[model samples]
Structure formats: C-alpha cells, structure tokens
Target: MSAAHVISILSSKKARTMTESSQAMEQWADKLEAVARRQDTQAFEALFNHFAPLIKAFALSSGLQRQGDHLPDELVQDVMLAIWRKAASYDRRKAAASTWIFTIARNQRIDTLRRLSKYQNDISADEIWDLEGDTELFGEIRQSRVQTQVRDQLKELPVDQRQVMAKVFLEDKSHQEVASEMGLPLGTVKSRVRLAMKKLKLSLEALDL
Candidate 1:
C-alpha cells in the first residue's frame, strides 16, 4: 500500500476507537441518570458493582477504615443510599454522573466521621439550665434565643476544632480516644477541644450580654 493510504487508514481506525469510547461513556452516564429518575434497581446495581470497589479503595486510602474489613463495605452502602435518595436531584449539566457519585461518596464519609464524633456525649438538663444562667427563668423566648445562639456559635467554629468538640462531647470520647482515632497527639486533641469550647462559650456569653 502507498504510505499516504496507510496513514489515512490508521487515522480512520483511531477515529473509530475514540468514537466507541465516547459512546460507552455516554451509555454509562445515561444508566446513572435512569437510576436517579426512576429508582431503577438494575441500573443502580450495575453502577454499584462497577464503582463499589473503587469507592472502597478510596475510603481505605483516606483512613476511613473500621478495625474489621467492614468500613469500605459500609461506606459503599452509605454512598449508595445517598445516591438513591438524591438521584432525583442530580443535574447532568452541572456534573457528570461519575463526578456526582464520587462527590456523594466523599460527603458521606465526612458525615460518617462526624456521626462517630457525636454518638454519645451526655449532658443533663439541670446543667443546661445552669449554663444558660437563669436565662430560662426570664422566659421561654429567652431560652430559645440562647439555644439559637449556641447552635450558631457551633456552626461558626473552625472545622478542626468542631470535629474535636463533636468527638469529645457528643461521642462521649475521651481526648485520648479522639487523639487515637484522629492520629493526633493527646495534647493536640485536648487543645482543640478546649479551644472549641472556649470559642463557643465566648460566643454564647456575648449573645447573652
């Protein structure tokens, strides 16, 4: 064959390969959208089978593992559940299907971590009343204001400190436990918890004033 003809043939073959790849990707995206719009179990199962191992690897690499080999599986389940619930909200224009699913998985991991941090910190109602410093005695309205202020202040806290606070108070974890789980020094964990508490208290105290 002439060199010119051979080059043209190779170029045509490359074009066909590219086209096939593009079509395959489009079909995958369409399947994801179908699951979102119709809650199609088969479509979801296909996606889960394809992406679960990848998501699990991501979770493990990111240090989200449980002691047993269950964290990756659990994390995949959580991601899939979020995808199921939020399928209708998916917007193809804003993000590709794979990108959207990955984002959901990432957010679920963060939520799982925060949930672990908030599992069991016990505080009594009497202590709460004292913390509000007779504000409730003034009126229900005053108590509501204090509650709102506390929530707002908590939201305003830096993410690192907030995580520490959640683990220490809500999860009922000791600072050592928080340190161990987070892979930080015990003093660092204590410092974060103390700083978070101080900032929250100051914000609430200012609101009370």
Candidate 2:
C-alpha cells in the first residue's frame, strides 16, 4: 500500500462503520471508501454528490447571507470543493457523512462571516461543549453524533438570531464589539444574543444533547 492507503487502513477503527451505512449509500460508499482509501477520484465524486446540498443549506442557515435568503451559488460551489479536499480524512465511525458535511458548511459559514468583519482568526464537537461550562458532557458524545443532532437544531432557528450566534461564537466577537462594528444598537444585540441562547438551549434539549 502507498502511504495514504496505509494511513486509511490504520485509522479505520475510528471511522464510521461502512457495514451499517444505509442501503441507498452502501454499494457506492463501499466503492468510494475503497477509492478514497487508495486516494483516487472515484471517492471524491461520490462525496460531492452526497454532501453538497447539505453543506450549502448549512452555510445559508448559519448566516452566510444577511442581505436576504438568496445565497451565491458560487459560495456553495467553493464549499463543495473544500468538502472534496477534506473528504479523505473523514472517519465514518465517528460521524455520518451528512453530519460531517453539515459541520463543514457551518465552519465555512463562520469563515465567511469572519472575512466580512475585521477579525484575524483561525478556528468543536458537542453542542454543549460549544455552549460553555459543559466540557465533560460534550466529551462523552461523539463528534459525529452531536453534529447529526445539532444540525437539525440549527435548522429551526430564525435566520437573524442564528446569524447573531454565529457572529458571537464562530467569529469570537463580543456582543458589544459586534454591535459597534455592525452599527446595530446595543439593546438589539443583547436581545438577539439572549434569544439565540434560549432557542439554542431548547434545541439542544430537543436533540437530547
């Protein structure tokens, strides 16, 4: 085996179980896994088709577009490229492809948000781990498992509120900083943060997170 194939064989224990993958995805997944394990193009195409929409929806929902619901297809396109680039390291045992894809889009959305602002930063698993004060519980849940639950929770939030949360946590900008920077009133910023947290808490509960 080449160095890459060697690595995949060594790490298979931590990846998702291909044996349990859905019937719809199993045959293709097996082929893709083989191609991916060997560092070939076949795996890449399969991932792009299975995960692109999920990534796009995540980016849009995480506040990629504030002007309106309309998002640039190019943004999704770029993110899909990123997905293709990163797909090789994915461990199926850890997270389903969908959860992993959603997280990628979520992170991409945050990256775009940071670019819009004047922050210099370079970047989590459990939703609770992200929320602060729950590191232990966060650790118990698998990253992939949490992503599966968290992505749906995120989908239910209002667009405006989700943007505020993303800006605060993802961008590491304070509410005051965001308010001053975005030129929104301080009261509005506080209100939005509070609302985002409340909704997030509820979502977490719903997900059994």
Expressed as tens digits, the lDDT of each residue in 133-201 for candidate 1 is: 332232534433443455558878999998787677544367898899999999999888778867766
Q: State each model's CA lDDT, in order.
A: 0.68, 0.59
Off by over 4 Å in 1: 1-6, 66-68, 117-209
- Each candidate's number of clashing pairs is 1, 5
User: Can you give the TM-score per candidate against the true fold?
Assistant: 0.50, 0.44
Q: Pick the candidate with the highest lDDT.
A: 1
- Lowest lDDT 10-residue stretch of candidate 1: 129-138
Candidate 2 segments whose C-alpha is farther than 4 A from its true place: 1-21, 24-35, 66-71, 122-209
Q: Give the 10-residue window scoring lowest on summed lDDT in candidate 2.
A: 124-133
